[model samples]
Target: MTQKDAPTGADATIPGKLPATGHQGRQEPAAMTSTPTTTRTSTRAPLAAHGTGRVPPRSGAVLAGLCAAVLALSGCGGQKGGSPAAGSVPDGWGTLATSGVSVSYPKAGSGSGGYTVQTAGERSKYNAAAAERTEHGVTVSLITIQLGFTRADTAEDAAIAAEAGIQLGSTIRSTRKVKLAGTGDARRIDFEFGSTGEDRTPPKGTRIEGVILTGLDSKDRTFAVRVDARKGTLPDADLKRIVDSIEVH
Candidate 1:
């Protein structure tokens, strides 16, 4: 075959020869000739190629979730704090008049004469009440209200009771219980002793008149009002009226 009719990459010419241009004859070139050539190479790639270091998309979402959880936990452990103001007493409670002094009681009752309650100290301060009445000639009107709670509401209830006691008198007494009546408001009551004559000391045969009246309000707050006076000085009928008048709304 001649070189002009040969296919690419196929060995077509003999060394140092060319076909001659003559009838039924060919002449070869003086020097051998060669054609231009090309070469190719290929590289394969992997399915998952890595880039410069970076956080995954889900990492940001996880971090946000963790931050939210920490905030919620901190909020749950917080506490409440404050102080009570005068005359800002809790609802369903009121003060009774007794001469120059006053006492705390339910608003329902009415009393005549000097059988009154005083919230001021020195006017009527509360001293300790022991197993029995002594030279003080005093008696305590005690009342206790029990409540049921699913958790520790004890501190809050105690604070409320203490505030009420302070407003009632300097010699006021108070306590708390976890179990209570249908309303679930726990409570306790104490008394104020009166001094006889001008000496401000316990008087001989000065019997103490004691009574406690209680009722519950819609807000689950218990109302316990107490009255302590001189037996003869405060009429039995009037004292009964005061006790019976306590009405809880």
Candidate 2:
């Protein structure tokens, strides 16, 4: 038998099968090969190392905390209202010894409780020293001491003579006698005076209030201590304390 060519087109059939036009005997489509797919996932690190994921504090807040810590460590923020301890001497006090006198003085500087001592000179017959305390360019308190040897009958007599000479252009406010420790009878005089220039007329707004104390030691030495304040600046108690602390050797 001659092999017949497979039928052409949709009518072709296998040799052993009967010829059929319906699509029942066609070879099934080749099995499809599936490609495997892989999924990739990514992870990110936390914002902070502490792992709590919180942002850092602001710079200003950090600086303020540091300052507060420093202040606390320095111990400088406790007292609100307080006073100096009783029976305690003021700070910055020092001793001044010159020309046979030794005394306690506040700090040393111009307008800050300093003093200058001068011994007897050709123009003056006494040893003198002056201490001054000032505020805002104005003298608030001044202490002046003069020491000399005199041949007067008594300390009071010598002080009166000295006062007469010193009060030439000054107004005497009052005079009295006061007793001092380790000294004989003493004379105290209060005065008010105005500053003068070559014209010999008192200057305006330059009135000074002064107190003078003169007495003699056991060896008949005449000593005088004067204190001057700008019209009401000196406290009586403080002045008394300063004068009482004077020591003349």
Candidate 3:
């Protein structure tokens, strides 16, 4: 039997895990100072003493101390914020969380269509995926949401990096800066696209609206959240709610 190409959009099955390949936050060595040591050696020194001081402590004890020191240095300077998400999950909504981030969405109902929560990762598309949900596929509604940690140093850098993913005919609508917890930096992007004639879902020529909100998480890790939907599939009110619901640890 011949294998079939998976349809694009929500029809694609998500892989079980996303390897975190994004740039990890770097830590500078803490300012350290050491007093110089002057050793005076005696040709016939006693076995209990080295050149000048008592025999060095056991290697195991020294190694344990050094390990603790390294961990202390590497663990400091962690910036924490954006936890306890901005708002409560909407009534009957679901949440997806991973890779230190979380997001909420509408739950499937008795009806055929509703929002979903997922961990979205496409190595070809994202640096580090956390939570994501693309509304529907297979001849149903249309919408997509994604949260990904980026490899950029700043929100501005990540925003520019994101532009590389725009489809051929898409048009950028607007871009703006946002604040997080009153101290963080963020960016919100809006755009539109005319679908290319493709065999997958969403049909051909559908007008799609897109919004991407990106920022540095509490720990200074870069993150990007995206939503794309057929012009009217998702309401603005619900959109704001979702964005407000993000929390990065």
Candidate 4:
């Protein structure tokens, strides 16, 4: 669907189902690096496959480490004079429930909607923590979040709320239709921009976008839903890598 086809306003209804043919399963190398702490536990590990299902490590450690790194970087820069007070530290990534739908937060980062809105500088500092790579002619840095819902709840409400900062028009335009692991289900959702043109240092091509997915468990409880976004438009190939990288079981 085109941008004009979408409803106007920031609070628009997200379209129901996306076309199934637009996305492809992509295989890419997963590279993990971890720094030693005072303890013996290593922080990073490739999520393991359990009985044909993808189950990632608890998102708590990864998110806490990333937040700590950002706070440290912000302190080092000492640029708080004009910058807004850093917003609430996000909750640890885990299962979140609201109404009927439930979702598991994907690994790689915290919950999608709870990000600390950073100034251009702050956003830049966080982006720098991840290894940089270019895909789809649009520069992209890999990112992830977990989405979850509780028993007896549907994930629809949470999914809608997560679209808050997203610009519906631009989002529809950039979403690449995709399917994961031969599941007949397809996914699509727009990216979100944290700052406008001049405020952003990345070239004009960079548009913050969100990737969304939905599913239901055996009991009919909606399960781990997800939306991922980064600073710019990502090549479909790169976008698939980020989406496929997510693990939930």
- Please name the candidate that would achieve the greatest TM-score relative to the true structure: 3
Better of 1 and 3 by TM-score: 3
lDDT tens digits by residue: candidate 3, 49-77: 00011112224444454333221111111
Alpha carbon lDDT of each predicted model: 0.23, 0.36, 0.38, 0.26
Error of 3 at 37 (Å): 66
Local accuracy of candidate 4 as per-residue lDDT tens digits, 119-203: 2232222111112222333223323222232222222222222222233233322222222322222223333432122221234
Give candidate 4 regions above 4 Å deviation: 1-142, 147-152, 165-170, 173-187, 191-206, 214-233
Candidate 2, residues 1-249: lDDT per residue as tens digits? 001111211121111010110000001112321112211111211111001111222244444543232110010111112221212224555444445343455554623344333222310222244444545443444454455533344544544433443322345544444444444345555555443211111233455565555556455666665555555555555554454555544
How high is the lDDT of residue 136 in model 4?
32
Q: Model 3, residue 112: what's the lDDT? A: 33
Which parts of model 2 are misplaced by more than 4 Å? 1-92, 95-105, 108-126, 135-140, 197-205
Clash count for candidate 4 is 27
Cα deviation at 103, candidate 2, in Å, is 4.8
Poorest 10 consecutive residues by lDDT, candidate 2: 16-25
Q: What C-alpha lDDT, on a 0 to 100 scale, does residue 143 get in candidate 3? A: 25
Every model: Cα RMSD to truth:
50.0, 53.5, 20.2, 19.4
lDDT tens digits by residue: candidate 1, 8-96 = 11111110000100000011223322111211111111000000011112244544552232110000001122121112223454544
TM-scores, in order shown?
0.27, 0.49, 0.55, 0.31
lDDT of 2 at 38: 15
